[model samples]
Target: MEDVKDYEIKALKKQIFISNLKAWIIGIILVAEIIFIGSFFSKMGTFGEESLSENKVAVVRYNQEVTEEFTTTIMERMDEIKEDETYKSVLFIMGSPGGSPTASEELSEYLKAFQKEMPITMYVDSIAASGGYYIASSIKPLIANKNAIVGSIGVIMPHYNFGQLAKTVGS
Candidate 1:
């Protein structure tokens, strides 16, 4: 009889140990998820005090190379501003040397669509060349400094034939 009682106790202890371990693992996972989500949201913004104001102005600064990441960040910011009714208009500040043609085209289209919802005014700080100028051209009422350089807009695709060089080198 004693042997049977000992066996039952051992089974219960094993079950309790497994349940406690699972609870600990689930708690750790929840904490990790919370940290990851918080960091993601924190890194995804350019707006500062203005975004929190009663009647905010979404200030988008295009002061970097217009890559896919840049375009994505701008699109996300625009979407966020659109959802928040507090944003009255957009102040698009520009200073770019231009970058990917595809990203530029994508951004231009998004800006045009965003314009239908809210007013977007552009201001050129220093320069806006190539894809940069291409994007700025979409927004209306653009204000630039008298000396600010704008519009050296064009796209170039260079093709190279290295086969001849490789053959000469006997590769």
Candidate 2:
């Protein structure tokens, strides 16, 4: 009787151990899947921000501030388009207030060079004014929305002319 009781206890412990092992393996697999899926979505820009497409028509979104990252992304897209034989033409859908004059000039020159090789189109969605307009003008065909604010062909110095305000405060 004593031997039988001991054997039963041992068997229960073995089954419990096996069950716990399976649960641990399942937990690890779940964690790994979560990590893999999260990383994949994040890299593909499905979660935070939409990524610039390489093979298809590249969509470059510019807001108030355009950073080096944006410029780099544009350059990368241009390179990809140059390499890809599937795309016959490239288009710049502009929706920007404006940006760095240097970046704008660089982008304009790049587009002009690209247009030399293949057909390029510029379509302004909302307001492609100032530097934005500068870039758009380089392209062959420029199209703007009916109510879109366009054209600001000039340079702006970053100096505040507050002489009148100072005089008023003194008086």
**Top-TM-score structure, candidate number:** 1
Q: How close to the true structure is residue 42 of candidate 2, measured as C-alpha lDDT?
A: 70
lDDT assessment of candidate 2: 0.77
lDDT for 14 (candidate 2): 99
Model 2, which residues run further than 4 Å from truth? 1-64, 158-171
Instruction: Report the C-alpha lDDT of model 1 over 34-121, residue by residue, as the tens digit.
Output: 9887666655533324322467677899999989998999899999999988889999998988998899999999999999989999
Q: Candidate 1 at 60: error in angstroms?
A: 1.0
Highest lDDT: give the candidate number.
Answer: 1
**Please, what is the whole-model Cα lDDT of each candidate in the order they appear?**
0.88, 0.77
Clash pairs for candidate 2: none
TM-score for each predicted model, relative to the true structure:
0.62, 0.56
> Over the stretch 1-171, how does candidate 2's per-residue lDDT look in tens digits?
999999999999999999999999999999999999987887676774433443445444554443456766887888887787656677778877677788888888888888888787788888888788877778879888999888876677799989999899985
